[model samples]
Target chain A: MKLQINNINKSFAGSNNGQSAVEALKNVNLTVAEGEFVCLVGPSGCGKSTLLNIIAGLTAASSGQIDCSGRLGFMFQEPTLFPWLKVKDNIGFGLKILKRSKEKINEVVDYFLELTHLSNFKEAYPHELSGGMKQRVALARTLALKPDILLMDEPFAALDAQTREMLYKELQEIWQFSKKTVIFVTHNVREAVVLGDRVLVFTARPGQIKKEFKINLPRPRDINDIEVTKISNAINQELKTEVAEAVKELEHYEK
Target chain B: MKNKLIRLAKPLTFIACLILLWQILYWLKIWPKWLFPSPADVWLTLVKGFANHTFIWGILISLKRIFIGFGVSIIIGTLLGFLIAKIKLLRETVDPIILGLQTLPSICWLPLALLWFGLNEKAIIFVVLMGTVLSLTISVKGAVLNIPPILINAGKMLGADGLNLYRYILIPAILPSYLTGLKHGWSFAWRSLMSGEMLFISVGLGQLLMFGRELNDMAQVMAVMLVIIVIGVIFDQLIFGKIEKNLRAKWGL
Candidate 1:
């Protein structure tokens, strides 16, 4: 295993002076092999993103152990590009922080900008870019660091359908080339099936692994392919009950 | 170019009309020449002061006090603000006091400053410092607090920690807000410096205004007041305004 998580759990204390705690995750265990792509899919409030955060060491797990062999990278749903920095500088931010020499930083930045096809917009700021372009810049920024494990939280969720489809093809190509182990979180079942080597379906709040499906589909799977739809439907069937349960939980809390 | 010229015409016409009105009022002899001098009289006084070098020397003296006082306030205010912002306990205890001090007018400190420094350069600079420091400190604290947490997290994820975190992320993130604070602080410092000079000092524009009053020279008083306004507008447009415009463009604000 390139990464191993054992018995992870997380809970948040209620804001109103010692009310009941919100259990976000419970007794989750998983492993990812080198260069494997795993997608986590679940209903709203299902702790999918929370688990990704825990793995990135962004949010601490309330209890559990995680073992990973190399440096990590994270891509958020929003681009999170620095508004003040130009596209090239935003891509090179991590390398600059690591105190890389100017020449090395420039070399890496140029390579990634070329990879992301953002050479034309290298001088543009985040606000000037479209949503897809901004996300591409963010992707370039993360990939420039070349972390062994990449954790992404709904990285394409905010984009339009056409833009998202194009990025999916591009991302698939990039992942095929880089072969980094990836743990991706998303709510879209079709996205999970198209992207993941294995898909882990999570239950509603206090999320646990409800089921796991191995995607035996071949490389460069189209999101619209019949095989992808079949897998997505299977996952969505599991998710439908979880969504209903989450709604019931909300109403129960209200009462 | 034509649009720009047309934009400039409105204000110029309004000013010309006001000046003509003032000259007409003077011609009516509604009050003694010592009480309400015409615009030409004020202009003549200004020209005479320039010829004698009193006007230039007075401006230089006032500017020296402003620079020194403003410089010290910026340094101390930034340090104090960062300290209070980072340390929760310090912020909790000191923030209210800073808020209270910000509300207090700069002139309110004039008496205390005069008592402490004895009506000299020290007293005037002290007043200027007091005028601006609280506002700068409060603004800096607010800027630091308002920085989006995601930026900080992104910095940390990029492997920046401790001092590097502040240098790379926090400082740049807060720069736009800090510039706004500097502009406000400068205006406060300018006002405080003028008020402080009016009572104690004898070598500044403020003192020149007082001297004209003592001699009942309304033209000279109006001349000095005009000089003060011109200086304020020039610095605001040339210095703070330019910096703010560039920063906003760079930040895509």
Candidate 2:
């Protein structure tokens, strides 16, 4: 396995205000084989993002063990590119930090810019690009690092449907070529169905893996494909009950 | 294009009305003609002062002092800003002292500056520095703190740590706010330079104002005041406006 998690638990200590401690993740065990594409689908507050943050070492788990030896790259929901940097410079930002020679940084940035089809925008600033284009630049920046594992937290959630679908095709092509281990977290069931080799469904708050679905579909699968829609429906049905349970739990807390 | 015309015309019209009111007050003899000079008197004084080259020389001298004082303030203030922003000990201790000093008007630094430098150019520059540096540092601190946490997290994940984190992310992220701080520092520097020159018997624009008052030349006083206002406007529009426009383009504002 390229990544493994064992009995991970995370909770937030309530402040001086009267609220109690809130559990975010509980007994979350996960493993991913090298070059595998895994999707984590859950409700909004299901702690899927928390899990990714922990794996990225950005956040600490209260009590857990996570073992991922490979270097991890994270892509955020927003592009989050440095506004002052040109497209090429933003892509080369990480390489410069690694103290890579200028030529090497340019070469690596050039490759990713081409891979992400952002070569034409090498001189453009982040603000000059459209939302989708900015996100593409961000993708190139992440990929430029050549991380062994990529952990994405709803990276396309902010895009329009047309743009998001276009990005989905591009991402699948890139993943197929790179074969990097990917753990994608999203609330969209169809998006998960479209992206994942294996889709892991997470429960509501204090989230854990409730079920795992293995997709036996062929590559370049369309979101509108009958098989993709069929699987997405199944996952949607599973998620609906959990979402309702979450609502009921919220109502109970209010009472 | 029409919007730009309207913006310019409106302010010009308002100023014309104010000048008309001032002339009427003079004709009504609210005070002596010397005390309340006619609008024409001030205008002729402004023209004559420019012709005699006193106003021109005064502007050059004042701009020179501000260029040095404000330049040093920006350099030293930005460094202090980084120190206070990055270090917890300095942030907690120096921050409160800075706040206290900022409340003390820029003119209040005159007494200490005169004693320390003994009525020289250094004293005026010292007072000017005190006016803006504290505020600039505070602005920089806020700018550094206002950076989105996600940017920092992404930087670290991309192998940036310690000084690399600041060089690659923190500094670029703070540029817009830093520009705003520079603008604020500029206005403060002007105010301080005026007070310093007025009291210290210096040969700058503020000296023109003082000389006018000493000679009962109300028109020169008003002319110098008008020159100061004009210079402030020119700097704001020429320098700060250009920088802000570029920033807007960069930020997609």
Please name the candidate that would achieve the greatest TM-score relative to the true structure: 1
* Cα lDDT of model 2 by residue, A1-255, tens digit: 389999999999987878889999999999899999999998888899999999999999999899988888999998988888899999998888888999999999889888888889999989889899989998899998899999999999999999999999999999999999999999999899999999999999989999999998998878899999999999999999889978887898788
**Count of residue pairs whose backbone atoms collide, per candidate:** 0, 0
Q: TM-score of chain B, per candidate?
A: 0.94, 0.93
Residue-level lDDT of model 1, residues B58-82, one tens digit each, is 9999999999999999999998999
Estimate every model's Cα lDDT from 0 to 1.
Answer: 0.91, 0.92
In terms of lDDT, the poorest run of 10 residues in model 2 chain A is: A13-22
Error of 2 at B53 (Å): 5.8
**Model 2, global lDDT:** 0.92
lDDT of 2 by residue, B16-110 (tens): 99999998899899899878899899999999999999999999999999999999999999999989988999988999999899999999988
Q: What would the per-residue lDDT of candidate 1 be over residues A35-81, giving only the tens digit for each residue? A: 99999999889898989989888899999999997999899998888
- Candidate 1 Cα errors over 4 Å, as ranges: B1-7
Q: Cα lDDT for residue A25, model 1?
A: 98
Docking class of 1: medium
lDDT of 2 at B143: 96
Candidate 1 positional error at A32, Å:
1.1
